[model samples]
Target: MAFSPLLDELVESLRCLPGVGQKTAQRMAFHLLERGRSGGTRLSQALSNAMDGVRRCDNCQNFADSEICGICVKPERRNGTLCVVESPSDLLAIEQAGDYRGGYFVLMGHLSPIDGIGPEEIGIERLLSRVKSEGVSELILATNPTVEGEATAHYIADRLADREILITRLAHGIPVGGELGYVDGFTLTHAFRGRKPLTD
Candidate 1:
C-alpha cells in the first residue's frame, strides 16, 4: 500500500539520517505523526537553531557557538601541552575520559590528497601559527588509527620540524581502524596515559 504524499515525503526526509533505511524511516515517520508531534517539532527547531548558531572555533577549529571555544578561554588548561584530534567527536570522547587537562587542536578532518583535502583545507597553517604564538611546547596526536590519520600526523610533524616542540602519538591500546568516538572511556584513558613520543 502506498502512503499519502505528505507521509511519503516525511519518510524520504527521515532517510537522510545515517543507518536509517526505508522501514526505519517509515516507522520513524509514523511515530512522529502518531505519538511524537511535539517532540518532532522541538527536534526540527533544535536542528535549525544549531545550524544557525554553530561555527568553528577561530583558534582550534572545534565547533563553537562563539568565536572562541570554552576550552580555549578556560585559563586552567595546560597551554604548553596540546592534544590534536581529527574531529570534534574525537575531542568529545577524550574529554569524556576525563583525565586529560591539556588544551586541544581539532583538525576537523585528516589529509586525503586523493579526495583533494590538503594542509590548507584542514587549517594546518592556523594550527602552526597557534603553536608558534601560543607557547605550545608539546603536541599529542590523538587522531584515529586509520591510514589517513597516520598520514595527517606525519604531515603535521614534518611541518613542525622547524619548531622547537616535543611530539607524541596516542598509545596502541586502540585497535587499527578504530575511531576515538567509538572507543570507551576506560580504553581512551589508558591510551592517553600510555602515549608514546614520535621523534621521527
Candidate 2:
C-alpha cells in the first residue's frame, strides 16, 4: 500500500535518524500519526527550537544555547585542571562519574586523516589558546582508546611538551569485574604497563 505524499515524506525524514531504516521509520511515522500526534507535535517543536537556538559553547566547544556553557561559568570548576574529551557525550559520561571537578575541552572529533580531519579541523588551536590563557596546571587527555584517539592525545601532548602543565592520559585496561581470560591482549598489555605498586 502506498502512503500519501506527506506521510511518505515524513517516513523519509524519520530515516535521517541513526539506525532508523525504512521499516522502522514507517512504524514510527505510523505510530505518531495514529496514536501519538500530541507527542509528535511536542517533539517537532522541541527539535525545531533546538535546531535554531543551540550552538557550540564558546569556551569548551560543547553544545550550548548560550555563549559559554553552564560548566564553564561555574566558579568551583575552575581548578586549573582541564579534561579533554572527543565529544559532549564523553563530557556527560565523565560528569556522571561524579569524580572529576574541573574544566573541559570538547574536541568534537578525533583526528582522521583519511576523513580530512586534522588538528585545525578539530579546534586544536583554540584548545592551545585556552590552555595558555587558563593557567591550566593539569591537562588530562581523556580521549577514547582507539588508534585515532591515541594519535590525537599524543599530538596534543607533543604540542604542550614545553609547557609546565602536567599532562596525563586516561588509563585503559580491563574493567573492574572483568576476568583476565576474557580480556583482550591490548587491554592486558595496557594494564601491565599501567600497573601500580601495591601499598602496604
Candidate 3:
C-alpha cells in the first residue's frame, strides 16, 4: 500500500537532517507515530519559533534575539580579548569550558574556495571591522586545526598584519585536522591556555 502524502512529506523532511537516510527517516516517522506524538508537536513548534525569532548578532554573528547577543552586550566580557571561531557550535564548545572569559566572533564556516565560499561569504570584512571598532587587544583564532581552518586563519592574519592586536592560534593539542566543535571542553580550555602566536 502507498503511504499518504502527509506521511511521505514527514519522511522527506526528516531526511533533510544530517546523517538521516531513507531508512532512518522512515524509522523516525514511525517513532513519532508511536511514542512521539507530543514530541512531534513540540519539535515543530520549536523549529518554527527558532527559525523565525533567532537572528545573528550583528557584531559577533552568534545567535541572538536582538541586535547583539548577550555575550557581546555584557560589559564584563569587554576585556579587549576576542576569540575567533569557525561556527556558533565552536563558540559553544569554548563557552562550555567556562575558563575563557572573553567574547567571540563566529565565522559560521571556513574558507572553501573550491566550493566558492570566501571571506565575503563568511563575513570576514565585518570581522575586521569589529576587531578595529571593539578595541580588541588580542585575537585568539580558535578555528579547527584542519587544512581549511588553517587557511582561513592565515587569511585573516594576513589581512590584520599591520594592526597592533596580538594574533594567536589555538594550540596544536587539538590534533591535526580536528574540529573545535568535537573537542572536549577541558581539552579546548587547555588548548586556549597554550595558544601560540601565528608567526609569518
lDDT of 2 by residue, 1-200 (tens): 37499899999999999999999999999999999999999999999999999999999999998999989989888899999999999999999999999999999999999999999989999999999998999999999988999999999999999998999988888899999999999899999998888982
TM-scores of the models, in the given order? 0.84, 0.95, 0.82
How much lDDT does candidate 3 score?
A: 0.91
Candidate 1's residue-wise lDDT over 2-103, tens digit each? 749988988888898999999999899889999999999999999889999999998889999999998988987755999999999999999999999989
Q: Evaluated with lDDT, which candidate comes out highest? A: 2
What is the full ranking by lDDT, best candidate first? 2, 3, 1
- Looking at candidate 2, the ten consecutive residues that score lowest on lDDT are 1-10
What lDDT score goes with residue 196 in model 2? 84
Q: Kindly report which residue pairs in candidate 1 clash with one another.
A: none
Query: Taking the candidates one at a time, how many backbone clashes does each contain?
Result: 0, 0, 0
Which candidate gets the maximum TM-score versus the true structure?
2
The reply for model 2, stretches above 4 Å from the true place, is 1-3
Model 1, residue 26: C-alpha shift (Å): 0.6
Clashes of 2: 0
RMSD to native for every prediction? 6.4, 1.4, 6.4
